[model samples]
Structure formats: structure tokens, C-alpha cells
Target: KTRQKGKKKKKNINLNQSKKQSVSFVCLTCHEKEEIPLSVVRDFDLMDDGDPTTPPMFSCEKCGGRMYPEYYEGVHGIKYRLSDIL
Candidate 1:
């Protein structure tokens, strides 16, 4: 009997893939949410900026720590990173 040829391995879309799109974000610094283009934001979030495997940590202008989105709000107010859009 003849042996079958080696089969090709399928590529995993999830494991290795970087989407190239003009991602937009908003930086809630002062009193307004600044619209950030992907080109601008990518510069700040570059691999060289932080640990290659982890996201960069930045300080917040409003409160402290990181500031992005305010998905959570209670008796006080929505707490999120103003940098979330960044």
C-alpha cells in the first residue's frame, strides 16, 4: 500500500493575526473627549513603549492610575480611563 502525502496544516486565525484598521479612540483629558486616529494612537501603544506581552500603564489626569472608559458608575460617578480612547 502507498502512504498518503503529508497534509497541510491550517492556519489559526485567532492565535496569530494583527488586524490593520484605522482604529479610532477618545481621550477624555480636559473637559472634552479627544478623537484619536489610529496613526497617532499606535505611536503611543507601540510594543517598544511597554512590555511586549502587556498593555502599557499610564497615569490619569482626572483622577489617578489609568483612565479609559467609565463603564462602571455608582453613587459617585462612572469610573473609567480617560485614556481608554487613547
Candidate 2:
């Protein structure tokens, strides 16, 4: 009996990274809007002081003011605003 040798095929791996989503943020003081990465927002939320009442916030590059997500739903399903922080 004769045995045949089989060749192994290499698998094509895709190293391409997925695109991150950009969230819209608005400056509380100046009302200026900008697009920020969702990963960054999640990182900020993770680094927060364990406060579930407040959402992740950022500093406005234009006015040096506080920026919050244009539309954020907290743990209680309530939209948080600058007034909520203050």
C-alpha cells in the first residue's frame, strides 16, 4: 500500500483593529460640542470615584470648561447634567 503526504494550509489572520466609536460631548460652560472616543469615556468612568450617580466627564479643549456626554443615561436611567454635578 502507498501513502500520500498532505500539505498543511496556513490560516489567514486579520490583524486589523476595529474602529472605535466617537461620542458627542458638549461643554457645560460654552455649549461647544466635540467628538470623543467611547473607549476614553469608558476609561474615565472606570477611573471615577465609584460614584454611580455621576457620569464620566471631560474638560473642554475650547473653553477650559467641563464637558459631559451629549446624552448620558446613569444607573438610575436619568440623564446627568452639570446641575447634577453641582
Candidate 3:
């Protein structure tokens, strides 16, 4: 019998580790949009009180006005608008 080379098996990758979860924020005054990591959302305690719809309001660094999550998209293919979440 002749020895033959074989292809190695591929391994599954952690999609979450590859791409970070994030949310999109928009400043009501300046209309500026920023995409931040999900961790930041947690830091802001947006998920507190067991309300996924109501995220804490933030201040815009540029305009000093209120910032809101106009749209939030996660790495796991989840997406929603402020109204949708609410």
C-alpha cells in the first residue's frame, strides 16, 4: 500500500470573538452618529431595570446634547431601532 497525504479538518471559529457587538448612537442636536461596543452599553447601564427597550440617554461629546440609540446592531445578526426596541 502507498502512503497518501490527507487534508486536515477545519475548525469552527467563534464569530463573537471575531467581531465585537456594538450599537449605533445618534446625537439629536448634531445628528452625529457613532458605533460603540456593546460593553459600553453595559457600562452605561442601559440594560438595567430589565428593560431592553429603554436605554439610558447619553450626552453628545460634540454638541453637548442628548444622544440616543437610533439603531443598534449586534454581531449575532440582531438589529433594531430605538422605536423598535421600545
Off by over 4 Å in 2: 1-20, 73-86
lDDT of 2: 0.67
The number of the candidate with the highest TM-score is 2
Error of 1 at 16 (Å): 28
Cα error, residue 20 of model 3, in Å, equals 5.2
**What tens-digit string does per-residue lDDT give for candidate 1 at 1-86?**
12222221223343233333233223334442323344544455554443433333334545444433222221123233434444
4 Cα displacement, candidate 2 (Å): 37
Which lDDT values do the candidates have, in the order given? Answer: 0.36, 0.67, 0.62
Task: Point to the candidate with the largest lDDT.
Answer: 2
For model 3 the local lDDT of residue 11 reads 19
**TM-scores for every predicted model:** 0.29, 0.59, 0.52
